[model samples]
Target: METTIALYSHDSVGLGHARRNRALAYALAEHLPDRLGGSVRGLLIAGHPDAGRDPLPDGWDWLILPGLTRGPGGTVPRRLGGDAEDLRALRAATARAALTALRPDLLIVDRHPFGIDGEFLPALRDLRAQGCAIVLGLREVLDAPEPAALEWERLGGAEHVADHLDAVWVYGDAQVYDPRLTGELPGALAHLATTTGYLGHGRPPAPRGERRPAGDGGPRAPYLLTVLGGGSDGAELARVAAAAEPPAGHHHLLVTGPQMAEEDIAEVRSIARPGTSVVRSAADVPELIAEASAVVSMAGYNTLAELLVTSTPALVVPRTRRRQEQPRRARALAALGAVTTQGIDTLTPAVVTDWWRQAVATRCDRTGIDLGGLAVVPRLAAELLGHGASTGRATTGHAASGRRAAGRRTASRQEVRAVAV
Candidate 1:
């Protein structure tokens, strides 16, 4: 028997959802044979224009949907270059068509259970009737509980999760931030919630020994890596960082991201000193982070995951305007001694200059934390498919040999790198 796994990432603005789902897709493609005693295939259906930038496994494929975005008050089409309603219809049709063709054994929906404007409901019903196991994937924190509850209720979110989803996986630890506390998990679907720790970006390229600062001759020019996930709301951070004085010998590279406007780039470049460099993106973000003395960025899921694995010191100025997810996650990480958080209001050039002057190592205390989520998710998926045990970590008892074999296969494949696309 062969099993098919389909992942839906309704990414509108940023690349977080698409990137996280892609990681899971690769992991599952490698581990499915061990758990199901059969061949496996992975399919990613996404609306992100840059989804094609990620590397796929041998058995993995993807479908790019019409890009759709949500505005302040309502839903709007993005990058469709055509009528909004027609594009939305096209996106819905494409998703349903993929569901029909793949007939997946398991389907994972990222972030939104019903998807924006209930675009996924028809497919959910069809998949459920076909006996497919559906799962909802969540980040550590969504907005604050009260507002989150209201939004969920208004969106009919609880009904969708309870009726359609077989399980929910949180890509974070419970002690750090619990979805239950946020009231996002309805009482009926509470049992489906499982915290799978933080998804790691494998090992960083820099050797662990080389991660330490230069020991000789006072403070050498530390390399400062500045990134803001999508770069839409990151102009201020980039501008201030470009103008701010670096630590004694610190040179700087500012990756404003692909979504940054031309004006924003020019603005950051206008004040950038001779040694400062501004790039739209990096080939591999984790590698770039590994080479940095420290990072200044927003508190997005992928960025946080990379920081955790690389054990890089980070100064996060979370975006907390319409959404509190960033700030909440940042504060939670700060509580665990993982990273430092600052307010955008206070992110003045002087403030950043003062902080970098003293900021040494702010790496979080990772003892006993779950950075193995890249491995744990496959185990959970196996359990949901009813062919394996439901252990929190990857099975290591009788399945240890299988895991080792999977590791070899993973190593032989292209090196796993986080793409900001």
Candidate 2:
């Protein structure tokens, strides 16, 4: 029999969660057949319609919920123009309906555990009743420790996490930067966690038989690229990078993502040096980064993942307006000589050229960082679902959760909380 899977990524913010789930879906489809001795099918459930644009496994599809945008206390309807509570209920119903029918053998949830407003609670209960293996996938950097604690507390803390999830996959290499050591991930959930390294490397482009994803096809080689991951909060970084001069002999192309305001994008284009290109997006960022002479980008998880796998020299200007996650990550990689860091406040075009000149001259070395997550995750999923064994590092085992497997719990006790952090 073939294994079935479903992934849920809240879409109130940028497409990072959805994109990460899509990448994992492709990786699982490519690798799981051998372990299962058959095939795999998947469904990616997301809040933004843009989630459907990305390619998936041969038989997999997408379920995009009502769009949402961050508001005062939590997420609000992006365009529905209705009450926030009503939209949350609608999204929850849609997800529950889809999963109740799909009955996936495994459910991999990215970031948000209970979904927005506890949307996944009913679906999780439904899947749990059917013995679906539930796993929470988290990016390596989850902001500084203090705020992370309060945020996790809002989500019902470690006890709540344990009550719902069977395992936790931290998508990063602890050797490069460990969240546990800094209390970003609490000790209570440590026993059920697994470090899956970065998911940016080894990600195959456009699933088989699918057309290539939409991008600008990127500029020619020996050129520098500047990109803002989501562009929602990247106006400052976009301006900085747009103002910076490309290396002496190379061209500079600034890609302002779609989420950025139109005025912001226009401003970036206006100030861009003559002969330079400023667009909204690219079809293949990893491919573009591989061919760049050097890259100037904000230090987001997805951006860092793309940087880590290749030998490209990048100058990361972490956004520290709200959280210290990006800055912390940049500093850690800088410590290992993997990449260089610059705070957005003090960064300037002249400083950019100085670093770009030297960085491209000597490409970065990421020899020690783990880049095998695309291969390890399938094995971990198979093992978690009782099909095979883990092929990667188990930061800690699920021995303590043996009791969890013996019982099923509903997430009713935990009131739905805000997911804006």
Leading candidate by TM-score: 2
lDDT of each: 0.76, 0.80
For candidate 2, write residues 287-395 as lDDT tens digits: 7777777888888888888878888888888889778988998999989988888887898877886877787676777868988788888887766655654444543
RMSD of 1: 8.5
Give the per-residue Cα lDDT of candidate 1 at 102: 77
- Model 2 has how many clashing residue pairs? 3
Best by lDDT: 2
Instruction: Please estimate how well model 2 matches the true structure, expressed as its whole-model Cα lDDT.
Output: 0.80
Q: Estimate the overall C-alpha local distance difference test score of candidate 1.
A: 0.76
CA deviation > 4 Å runs, candidate 2: 206-217, 391-395, 399-421
Q: TM-score of every model? A: 0.86, 0.91
- What is the per-residue lDDT of model 1 for residues 1-421, given as tens digits with 9 covering 90 to 100? 7878999988887888888898888778777788889999979988887876666777888788878877765667786576666777788888998888777778899988777777888888887766677888998888888888887787666765677766778888887888876676666555567778888845223334443223222122467888888787788889988888877678777888878899999889999966677877664667667667888899998888887776667889999887889999999888887888998987888887777776644444556556777788888777666666556453323233333333343333223212211
